[model samples]
Target: MENNLLNLRMTSKMLSRQAKRCQKEENKELEKLKKAISAGGTEEARIYASNAIRKKSERLNITKMASRVDAVASRVQTALTMQQVVRSMGITVVSMEKAAQSMNLEQISAVMDKFEQQFEDLDVQTGYMEGAIGGTTALDMPQDEVDMLIQRTADQDGLELNAELANIQAPQYLPDEAS
Candidate 1:
């Protein structure tokens, strides 16, 4: 895949160079055509214009071919990248399988249970902390005092507090009958 992609990139570069050469030749022909047209000779001007138009058309075709080559190169690069990712993932999967084979069901279950207990403990501690903080702080303070505290903290932290607590509505509680 890498070799193929490299070849494609090289081909794209060569095509682009060919296109640029054609464009330069076309420009030269166009300059000659312009001079002939300005010289006031109808027959010569007609011949030059026809040749220039043909050369311009060829240049356009070359440019189109170059664009196609570049697109193919881009696609090849994308494929190469995807191939690398898939190869890495395959390696990871094999390693995971090997590791899993070494671990017993009991061990896995114990680890999972340990993690669950830790998380439950953390949640309980978080809830307790929240309740304690709420009871001692804003919940027990006057609205103006809370606002003043918030403003002072913001000022100390170099933050501009533009939020209005009044604009935030509390969650509406619905009775079981309403539900």
Candidate 2:
């Protein structure tokens, strides 16, 4: 489980780096677009616009891939946890069966008498252990975070296009004032 999660994480990191490169290239293209627009070079602006759009698309795709990988890693963790629970339950059932077969009324009574205190002590001990060793690994990139990542990419896709285009209005019949 850990190995699978680690591999997915590494893949995600690589995708992230690729996405960052895409973003840098997109930013460069956008900057060039601004220069082209300023210089009244419509052809250059068109090329830069295409390149920027392409790069942004790549970044969005890479982000989505990373998010999916993270989701898989989370699910893998969940499955492993569920497996442990099932194993524990099986062991508990077996123990109960053995206890039922061997224990007399007096033995049962005595265990019942101590069960509450023992359970409480176990809880306290487990709590301290958890506090000492617990980590985000057990709850990494939950569904909500994956959803947020997807939502952000969706919002960013629209916002990037809208905001950049909005800022670049056509010359409003005035000469140099448009710049």
Candidate 3:
């Protein structure tokens, strides 16, 4: 996935350069055609300038189309990649292809952004709750209250959790045997 993103980044950079070059050439041609039309008189330069303008416009349109295509493709690819990542990790995420077909790119992008933010929030909340649960600070709660909270947490889905802790033992750190 990272490789795909890197490839996309490189391709976009190349495409941007190409598009810029095309635009510059078109602008230069248009300027020359304008000067020719102004200085050489309409009867002599009209057809030449008209043809030049049409060709330049076509070139510019093609450049813009290419840019739009590249951008859409990149976004769709990223969304598909995100879906794959979720599936591989046994996590359920919104489908990118479906979103691409149904929603505008901006909407899909917004949803993806929100999804990422939510995940970050969940991570921070999980860490804080875990710390509170396992911390040395004693809670004034009754045993039943702690038990209910533990059970509630255990019931949640898609949390990448293992067996519930019966006791908060000090976590072990193993030295790398390969070292």
**Which has the greatest TM-score?**
2
lDDT of 3 by residue, 1-179 (tens): 55665675576567667767766766666677677777966654666556657666766665555555455445555455456545633432444455677878876786677668667765665565455433422343566656555544554543333556554332233233235
Report residue 150 deviation for candidate 1 (angstroms): 55
TM for every model, in the order presented, reads 0.53, 0.58, 0.36
Backbone clashes under 3 angstroms, per model: 0, 0, 0
Cα lDDT of model 1 by residue, 45-126, tens digit: 7777777777778767766665665556555555555565566556655655655687877655655565566556656655
> Candidate 2 or 3, higher TM-score?
2
Q: Superposing all C-alpha atoms, what RMSD in Å does each candidate have to the true structure?
A: 23.8, 12.3, 28.4
Q: Candidate 1 or 3, higher TM-score?
A: 1
Residue pairs in collision within model 3:
none
Q: What value does the lDDT take at residue 134 in candidate 3?
A: 39
**Candidate 1: what lDDT?**
0.62
Candidate 3 wrongly placed segments (more than 4 Å) = 1-7, 41-44, 80-179
Each model's C-alpha lDDT?
0.62, 0.69, 0.57
**What is the C-alpha lDDT profile of model 2 across 1-179, one tens digit per residue?**
78997897799789889999999999999999999999999999999999999999999988877777766766666666556656655665665566678977765565555555455655665565444323323344465445445445555576443553343433324332356
The Cα error of candidate 2 at residue 165, in Å, is: 14
Model 1: per-residue Cα lDDT at residue 13: 76
